[model samples]
Target: MGNMSKELLREYIKEQNFTNANDILNGLKEMFRDVLQEALEAEMDEALGYRKYDGIEKTNNNSRNGYSKKTVKTELGPVQVNIPRDRNGEFEPRIVPKYQ
Candidate 1:
């Protein structure tokens, strides 16, 4: 089961009398979208800078609260991403446009 081919996967599904591949495919697609969204969120975090509050500031500290928003595109379609923000007014995100 660890090294099954695509053809064998289809055969096993057929043998199990399964016909709702759409649901599974959609679920996987959703999973992929979730992962992509996470990547975008992390990108925003890095772009805007982030750090944990430990009651002590480091040598070079830059951290703030983050936010999320929904956006659409013609190629990648729609995505719900977290927009990062900082308190030092030195970070700005460049993904999906600020007005989109």
Candidate 2:
């Protein structure tokens, strides 16, 4: 997980204007889903040895193919997340396993 600055958190909460318990829970779920998605993207970048859209330092031919939608069951409920895929089919996500 990454550190979210207080200013950014405050700004996000203000934008949300959470007024009830259910609203707060829903907001948390959204945050969790977003963080998980970002982590998956970062993992792909690391595995492929270059960030997406940057062909400067790319040494291999493997590249980003597309995304596969997977429903992750969390304590909050089921959240739909897009798992990044590589062209060579060697990108196995560790955050949410392919078989999980």
Best by lDDT: 2
The 0-to-1 C-alpha lDDT of every candidate, in the order given, reads: 0.56, 0.93
- TM-score of each candidate structure, all chains considered together: 0.46, 0.91
**lDDT (10s digit) by residue, model 2, range 1-100:** 2588889989998999999999989999999999899999999999999888885967889999999999999999999999999999999899999998
The per-prediction tally of clashing pairs is: 0, 0
**1-100, model 1: which lDDT tens digit per residue?**
3676999878756665645887566544555567656665666556544434446544455666556565544334454555555667555555445566
lDDT value, residue 100 of candidate 1: 61
Assess candidate 1 and give its TM-score to the true structure: 0.46
What 10-residue stretch in candidate 2 is worst by lDDT? Answer: 1-10
